[model samples]
Target: MAFLALQKDGTQRAWAAEHLWPDCTPYRAAGNLRSALCHARRACATPVVETIGQSLRLAPTVRVDLHDAYRAGDEVTAGLSPPPGTENGLIEALRQDLLPEWPEDWLVIEREQWDQLRLHVLETLAQQLQATHRFVPALQVALAAVGIDPVRETAHRIVMEVHIAEGNVASAYKCYQNYKDMLERELSISPSQRMRELVEELMPR
Candidate 1:
């Protein structure tokens, strides 16, 4: 079901069976796929999964939350306002991992892809909010990105920039110090020169 959902163009039953039950024999995997398909049909009140010839996909009318998030991120990157109520909603949505507790090889790549996309969108949204003096939500959005990947320099940079925008130089400096320490502790590295320059600009001559 997830395999079909993730694919925009749908997938062949043979291909999906091979990937989903890679450890099983071809006959066993095909049997498993058929059983799973039956369960999927029985679990839904309306048809969520659709079959076309030998390919499977989510029905066109089904709403995928991940696809919605991707669209919201696209709107942010394209310099468009997200639909009503989605500004803060996007922040909350990006804060979640795409099935973090799911332990499957196929899921890992999708999860990582979502993580990267959300981080980029969060940072961009934070910058947009900051440019318009929406400092509180800017900070919230930036901090959500930081929470996802603490060592992401861009997210921390946006965090510092948000503080600096509101004349909270002390808070910005503290954020820089924490980020610097985290980098050292986690990756045995220092914050990049760009990050240093951002903080250094706040210091008096």
Candidate 2:
């Protein structure tokens, strides 16, 4: 499945048999490649995978979550607000790690790319919620972003802003202090000056 996914795309969907099995020396001698392709064709009863001129192509009916998530994230980043009542589910889907169990280098790279993309999406969603004065959901999205990448200062800052907007000065201060402690303990560094200023602005002094 992974191999086929790696090969498929909108413009170029087919992969030559030679490309799929570069070393046909042994397999061809034993007729293993032919037998395997035959079984694969049979297994794809719905015809999602079809042979075209000695190459395999995935049908348009096939859809991948990774692709869908990316497209949605792009749309969100491009200022397309998600429909009401679907924010939580969309956020949850974006939070999922891509192919966590896969140890392949390609999978690792793609996973990291998706992770960053989702973080951006989360941050954007939080900002949109904050703009609309939806502090509760904004806070939730900010916290989820922080949970995914604890060292991301933008998420921490959004969380602080949401708490402050909700009139929870104490909670905002506590969140800042916790972030400060975590940064110091983990990276031996303090929060950014801008972040410190934000907390100071909320102080009673």
Candidate 3:
């Protein structure tokens, strides 16, 4: 399924066959590709590969995270405001990965591009939602952005501040804890002192 997402539309299956089985006979490679693609579809529960005169595309119905991220990003660039509460969904809809467990291969390059676009668009949505005083929705978007890219400290802080402002100290602390744990466990690092200090402060009742 993921192959369809990563592959360029209209590429000859022979191109894919060659890559998948570099050492094998071209006939064998082409046969393997067909089998692999069929298995991929069943496993992912989507028809990710479509054939149109020896060319392929991801299934038309399979909405990819990268695609949604790009579309949402375009909408924002065109000054289209997202419906309130939908901003976070938009961010979440732009899933952190198209197929996270897929083996690391040439697709890493495409993954990196998707990663960048998803973060950029989600962060933009977070900021826009915040400006409109849709604090809960904004917080969700910000949190999603941070999840997709934990290095985005600004997005994390924004979620914290929004929660505190809304008098949801528990939620604010949970956000802090989750992010703090992720960094510490995954990267062997701690949250910034500024983040630590902010979480201790109380919100107005």
After superposition on all CA atoms, what RMSD does each candidate show versus the true structure? 1.4, 4.0, 6.0
What's the lDDT of the predicted structure labeled candidate 1?
0.88
Better of 2 and 3 by TM-score: 2
Provide the lowest-lDDT 10-residue window in model 1: 1-10
lDDT of 3: 0.74
Deviation from native of the Cα of residue 165 in model 2, angstroms: 0.4
Q: What is the lDDT of residue 41 in candidate 3?
A: 71
State, as a TM-score between 0 and 1, how close model 3 is to the true structure: 0.60
lDDT score of residue 45 within candidate 2: 71
Compose the digit string of candidate 3's lDDT tens values, residues 50-124: 788788777777766656666777787567876666665666667557567877464677778877777777777
Task: Put down candidate 1 lDDT per residue, 1-205, tens digits, no spaces.
Answer: 6677788778999999998998999999999999999998999999988889998999999878878888889888888877777677777788888777778788878888889999989888899889999999899889989889888899999999999999999999999999999889988999999999998999998
Tell me the TM-score of each prediction against the true structure: 0.94, 0.80, 0.60
lDDT for position 28 in model 3: 96
- Residue 153 lDDT in candidate 2: 96
Model 1 bad stretches (over 4 Å)? none
Better lDDT candidate (1, 3):
1
By the lDDT metric, which is better: model 2 or model 3? Answer: 2
**Model 3: runs farther than 4 Å from truth?**
19-28, 34-54, 58-66, 83-88, 153-205
Question: Residue 19 lDDT in model 2?
Answer: 43
Residue 189: error of model 1 in Å? 1.0
